[model samples]
Target: MASAPQAQGLPLFYNDLQPLSSDLHANYKIRRAETAPFLAKQHAVPLTVEEFPLVQRYLPIVFSMGDEPVPLGLMGLNEGINVFFDADGKFRENEPFYIPAYIRRYPYMLARLRPDAEELSLCFDPTSDSIGDFEEGEALFEDGKPSELVQQVLKFNEDFEIAGQKTNAFMKELKELGLLMDGEVSIQPDGAAQPYIYRGFQMIDENKLNEMRGDQLRKIVQNGMLPLIYAHLFSLNLMREIFGRQMQQGAVAQQEQPAA
Candidate 1:
């Protein structure tokens, strides 16, 4: 099976992929995450296009830099800092954050059987603590067949895969239309002397949209791309909110630290 899409310090703890089979994994149980401490260090998390509306209300969404530009929800602006997660990787301040399905589909990923093969197999990261050796959690298999829980995970993965395809296609169309361009954002916090300048990203060029031919605009609208583009633009405001959250949290952390 194709390995988890590799990136530097990304897709955390998903190493040593093993294709799910009844023989080897029948006894395997996954420990339900009581806390999301794993997410504490993450700033950006992969997001599906379908999640734009829900996520926009909570966090700014951006495109990851690469040939395949995956949609990413900006959990924090700086590296190794996620404002959404607390010290224990749980939600901060007991506030409700829209958990992206991508994060929810942790440990298990639908990987391709072969490079050229269209078929996909359910795979899990054996290294994850979520995958358990204990008999208390839900079983991966029962009667030598995938259990109900396994089927649910599989369905979730399948839906994720389908959404991924749609996002890819949308990105491809954006590229073809030359609508996406290099993006940057600058944020100046209340007490910071220097503004934080973020670069090396992609965003829809509104100027280009303004210059677009009427027919082209209609075509994009027909493709159901307009709302998504607007959603992204509208969500940019939340970046400042995220920065405020970060500063507030940073202060709290510093206050809690024992002085040298």
Candidate 2:
């Protein structure tokens, strides 16, 4: 893990997002064990799978552990921890796709890790209309090949290194957490990649319906239980504004009724 950057002039929200517990190491180990196999099978390779509950999974952990108001520098790190799917299984970088900037940062990290002349100068053209714009290109099912994008991700992980002390510290933490998995999990560049599909969670229209249903259900049981549970505390603040306006209108109506 990199040293947390300086906190000068940063918002209080950034500091409020520290790790909920030191149990992240164990969580990550279990997640990796489970996801690796699923991804491998999806890609038609031999791999392991670990059963992970969606709510108790990666994004939640990252959100709980992330420093907030998140530094722009670290915003992408969380996105990288999760997997993505494309309906068409093909992506070009310049297009306004949903992939976050932080997710795109992996190629940069890979270039730093490998440092080969051809690889280093690969110029990840974030602005290009070419298919190369996205590191993971479309999965080629006919040839059983992963998209270029997946290749880039693997290349980066292959080359990442930490400072000696930091590496030791992370290792110690891993050992203490009992996650001393020895072998490196590699997704070969030429391996068949999994078909990309749209994640239902990312589907906005359906999600809106689900959210509304949850809101209504919670309101019935506890007035606004769902809002509080979902961390939409601002909704209460908005209600206060509406209440104030209603009160002002009532005051005007009372005055007019007396005058008439």
lDDT of every predicted structure (CA atoms): 0.78, 0.24
| Cα TM-score of candidate 1 | 0.88
What does candidate 2's lDDT look like per residue over 101-217, in tens digits?
233332232232233545432223222232221334343122344445446544543433222233334324323333222111111122324221211111012243254555455
Residue 234 lDDT (model 1): 89
**Candidate 2 segments exceeding 4 Å error:** 1-84, 87-102, 110-168, 176-260
Per-residue alpha-carbon lDDT of candidate 1 for residues 17-97, written as tens digits (9 for 90 to 100):
778989887788877877776687778877778889899999887776667676778877776788878777877666666
Q: Which 10 consecutive residues of model 2 have the lowest summed lDDT?
A: 43-52
Q: Which candidate leads in TM-score?
A: 1
TM-score of 2: 0.19
lDDT of 1 at 81: 80
